[model samples]
Target: MKKKITVKLDIQKIVRITGNHGGYETGECLLCEASGWLEGEFGSPYSTKDTGADLVHKKNCLMNKVLA
Candidate 1:
């Protein structure tokens, strides 16, 4: 019999921002201020839908790494 090993990724600490902030003008990580392609497309500190910003932060934000 062969045993299958599974690895668990900790995602409990990941925070998703989904609000409109008057001060938010760039699509950057609110915690680390890291900017990505989403920022270029949607402008920095975006106030609209945050799905793109969330994706970018999850992929490249230093804050996400630290939290994880």
Candidate 2:
């Protein structure tokens, strides 16, 4: 039998990397005003790719959705 490997995203690490004073996530949030989340843009922060934190902005931030 072969084992499957799964890699889960760490919200705490994402929060720290963003220079925020908190670390936590609940369910699948698109944009959490209480948490100060900002959706995503269509351009590039460049460094975001290096740290792999873009997932929060693109997948959960919900900023873009709000703008629409």
Candidate 3:
């Protein structure tokens, strides 16, 4: 019989890496007005990307702003 190898992963590390840390901070979500959110120009903000249908701006706006 062969033994199986199972590796356990940390959820906190995964969340931090995946950038899925949900919380109320500053500059986080432009829509929800969250903080610690990434900012960038994802999609065409001047085009149909801001039709309230496509929320590609949020994804594009991933700015890393740290507090002093």
* Candidate 2's TM-score: 0.20
Q: Which regions of candidate 3 deviate over 4 angstroms? A: 17-68
Candidate 3 has an lDDT of 0.30
Please give the distance, in angstroms, between residue 40's alpha carbon in candidate 1 and its true position after superposition. Answer: 14
Model 1 TM-score relative to the real fold:
0.21
Model 2 per-residue lDDT at 37: 31
Worst 10 residues of 3 by lDDT: 59-68
Question: Residue by residue across 1-68, what tens digits does model 3's lDDT show?
Answer: 99998655432332221244364212223432323332232222222334443222333332111110
What are the per-residue Cα lDDT tens digits for candidate 2 across 1-68?
A: 99998655444343322333254222223233222232342222223443433333343453334333
When superposed on Cα atoms, how far off is each prediction in RMSD? 10.0, 12.0, 14.0
Candidate 1 structure quality by residue, lDDT tens digits, 1-68 = 99998645433333333444574433445544544433333233332355643434434444434443
TM-score of each: 0.21, 0.20, 0.22
Question: Whose TM-score is greatest here?
Answer: 3
Backbone collision count in every prediction?
A: 6, 1, 15
